[model samples]
Target: MINQIYRLVSPGRFEITYRDMSLNGNKLVVRPKYLSVCAADQRYYQGRREASILQKKLPMALIHEGIGEVVFDPTNEFEIGQAVVMVPNTPTESDEVVEENYLPSSNFRSSGYDGFTQDYVFLNRDRVVPLFTELNNHTASFLELVSVSIHAIRRFKEKTHKRKETLGIWGDGNLGYITALLLRKMYPESTIVVFGKNDYKLDYFTFVDKKVLINDIPQDLNIDHAFECVGGRGSESAVDQIINCINPMGSVSLLGVSEEPIEVNTRLVLEKGLTLFGSSRSGTVDFQDAVNFLQQNKEVIDYLSQLVTNVIDVYSIKDIDSAFEEDLVSSWGKTVMEWKI
Candidate 1:
């Protein structure tokens, strides 16, 4: 079969090309139903990444956050028309101590190879996760991101100091919102405080114990732990503030992607006895846990639904560009694409 794939040949340029797909002994074949635009995807589309990195990663399919329907499954692991979330992390080798995502051999879709932008996606059974029928397509499309948050929180729980009375999350973006929400759900007794610059965006986080402006934080305010979701140019300030406000022996989970290297207050970190950890792409287990978390916590679904600001349907290559363009201008919320092709 010839698969119609949309590839980013260069910055601000895309092309549709056909490639032969061999279905020999393939367990599952999925057709994308909905796709979500992530900040990383936008960076690739707009050439925000370093030129050297783009030169090696371009001309590849660009979306890793997507939901699809099973078109064919030889083993009948999933129903023919069942909905499933595509797992982008492909691990060829694994170690007992190191997780799949941390493995150097893991090939992440949309990073080094083709993603789910093709007309049909062929996968091994483990690469696709089954989703509940009631889950909305828009929410399911971004399950990858949710799974990433889940993974980060899991790491925090395993490595952080036992004191969990107050948790501070820095950044008012979508990632910050999701991390705060998950923290509340996972640790109901702990107070979750969000720190960010945008008043309008911070307003949506009413479920948190407190939302404080980064510039206006009270000197007396302190947190037992902190998660730094602020990446990019603002990361230095966020990390410094976290270091100052967090309690001694506190742990910091870093989730945001920094385009360029930023300086950290290593002296403060050492003096405070802080343990800092970074979480990147997630694996199959994290994906499953994310779906189960959503299914068990029905109310979280309603809260997450608020993150969908723009829903655009993509019927052609031009629509793909338009969705990326609109996502660039949207101040808050996630831009989801209803895959029509």
Candidate 2:
């Protein structure tokens, strides 16, 4: 069958491309249901990336965060019409020491290869996790991002010491919100504090124990561990602040994606004997963990549902363009596309 893929051929432009897919193939075929736009997609849509990087990765399908329905499953591992969250990381080779996301050989969708902005997304059997029937479609659309926070938190648990008295999260964006929410539930006894530059943006984090303005933080304020979700230029100072405010021997989990290299206070890090680890894309296990986390704690869906600010229905290439355009202006919440196109 011929599949129609909506690709961004250039900045602020989208073109549809056609390709043939085999129904008899080993892969499971899915029809995208709801797709979510994120910061990375915004960077590409607005031509914010470096010229060389853009030149190398143009004309690629754009959304990686999405939930789809199984249209065909040759192996019968999944029933037809099953709702599933599509995993974007594809790992060809597995390692004993390195996780699939950290593996150098892995290929992630929407980075260089085609993503889910196609008529149908062909995926490995392991790449799609079945969603609970109670999950909201719009909330499940961004499950990929939720899985990322799950992956990062898992790493934090493994690397950080057991002194879970207080936890600090910097950045009041979507990622910071999700990470803070997960940490709050996972460590009920620990205090959760969120720090951000804008008070209005920080207002969304009412569930956290405390909200601190980044500049007005008390000198006596200290966190046992910190998660830095502030990416881009803000990361430099965020890391510095985390190093300053975090307790000795505290672990720092870096989940932000910096466009350029940021300077870290190695002197302070050495003096404090702090351990810092960075987490990127997630694997199937993380996706499963994320799905299970949401299923077990149904109340989290209420908190997460607030993150969906815009839901646009798509029926054509023009609608796809509109979705990206509107997502660019959305301030605090995620923009979801109802994938009718």
What is the total number of backbone clashes in candidate 1? 0
Candidate 1 versus the native: TM-score?
0.98
lDDT of each: 0.92, 0.94
Flag regions of model 1 displaced more than 4 Å: none
Distance from true location, Cα of 284 in model 1, Å? 0.5
Which whole-number lDDT from 0 to 100 does residue 218 have in model 2?
97
Which lDDT tens digits does candidate 2 get at residues 1-341?
99999999999999999998888879999999999998999899999999999999998999889999999999888899999999999999989999999888899899888999999999988899999999999999999999999999999989989998999999999999999999989999999999999899888887899999999999999999999999999999999999999999999999999999999999999999999999998999999999999999999999999999999999999998899889888888899999998
In model 1, how large is the Cα lDDT of residue 39?
Answer: 90
- My TM-score estimates for the predictions, one after another, are 0.98, 0.99
TM-score of 2: 0.99
Candidate 1 lDDT over 224-312, as tens digits, reads 99999988888989998999999999999998888778888999899989999999989999999999999999889989999999999
**Stretch of 10 with least lDDT, candidate 2:** 324-333
